[model samples]
Target: MKSWRTMSICLLTLFLTILMGCSFSQESGEATGSSIILEFSEIETITDAGVQLAYDDVHEVKKIDNSFMVYKKTASDSHLYLGSVRDKQLTEYGFVGEETYIQDFTKNEESLFGRPMTLITGICGANCVENYLFEQVDGQPQLILKLSGHVLVADLNEDGEKEVVMMQGSPQIEIHVYKRIGDQIMKVNLNEEIGLTNSVTYNSQTNVFEMIINNETKQYRYDTDSDSLISL
Candidate 1:
């Protein structure tokens, strides 16, 4: 009878331990989920040109020096606005177009036309994306360049300037490179498309750009003279 009692007690203790562990795991998961939702969905307030702007469902908020860029989405459309705070005053600078399907807004690390730039991506179709590049100029945001497909920016030539690499994924994957010369942003003539690519990224260590396609990696360097990407 004593042995039976001991066995029952051991079984009950094991069951209780598992129950407590499960409860703790569930609570932890709930807390993490709530944190993420709050981080994105919480109501936020900002002063734009002395006008109070209260927004929720915030997609992204970026700070550039004394300026702030906020991207917010609604059930049907999305809005992006830039504002600056100086001398205890808030001033609105620019507003993006009424885009119905804005996907992402990001700031490039490099400057364009000797000014900071930001990119806004919008979805047009099942596999098509439009990228709008905006440069902060004279206390305002100016739309400088626009492209279709996936875009990545880097100083591909190490020339103290950033280049835009675009990969078009529909119909077939095509790679295009663009560089700013003087006041014009010109598309580099590769003569031939880089063929198929899953993604393109800059490798700072190698000072070149890397393209991945079907688990295969290829490296490329921009040729200033030829105006093309030389596969290495």
Candidate 2:
């Protein structure tokens, strides 16, 4: 009986030791996964001065975070750079061709998944504007969304998360709305009764997206429960 008890105690100790080892490995992996190391430059030298008459002329340095910075010039057909402060590497994110320039770049106050985002606009053609939404994922700059025209991010349906609204085509008759579903972005279906119009507006009173066509109004409210839009 004494021998059996001693063996049982030894087995219990071995099991506990293995379990603790597994737990420690998992914790270490989680910590390492949370921190992402990026390969960036450590110098101010930039390639493709980008339509600038003068080489190495950069202005308007904006700091997005401790690691990322954006710099651009105000001259016509200028370039924009997204650089890493820690690494000192610069990437030209703005337009470069002739008859084009960096229009505007804005950093939204809201964040998703503990990562901040920036909206950038550049003119590519006579009537074409390229809109890009950049987010930091795993400590690196990521281009999450690119659109033909400009985009607006707002809680159009008064939901907790904001939705993306994009106006496509020349007359802006084709308005598209995208919402976040699970880990993907999906387009929201509009009510069939809603007519096609370029005069789309958000109605705060009803918490719905509205459009006015030929003096007639059509409203569509997003049903969070159904993940669809209901005509109001």
Best by TM-score: 2
TM-score of 1: 0.44
Query: Residue 190 CA error for candidate 2 (Å)?
Result: 4.9
Q: After superposition, how far is residue 46 of candidate 1 from its true place, in Å?
A: 30
Tens-digit per-residue lDDT, 1-232, candidate 1: 9999999999999999999999997755432221111111111232222343443333444444445544444444455554444444444434543345333444444575355677665555567666656676776555566566777666776767776767776544555667666666666323133333244555556767565534667566666655545666
TM-score for each of the candidates: 0.44, 0.50
What is the lDDT, from 0 to 100, of the residue 34 in candidate 1?
19
Model 2 Cα lDDT, one tens digit per residue, 1-232: 9999999999999999999999997755331322212121222222432222222455544566665455665654244555443333355444422233433444454443223666655555566666656677777566566566556666764655676766566654455666665666556323222334455555445556666544656556666665545555
Stretch of 10 with least lDDT, candidate 2: 35-44
- lDDT values of the candidates? 0.54, 0.53
Summed backbone clashes in each candidate are: 1, 1
Model 1, stretches more than 4 Å misplaced? Answer: 1-109, 122-126, 189-220, 226-231
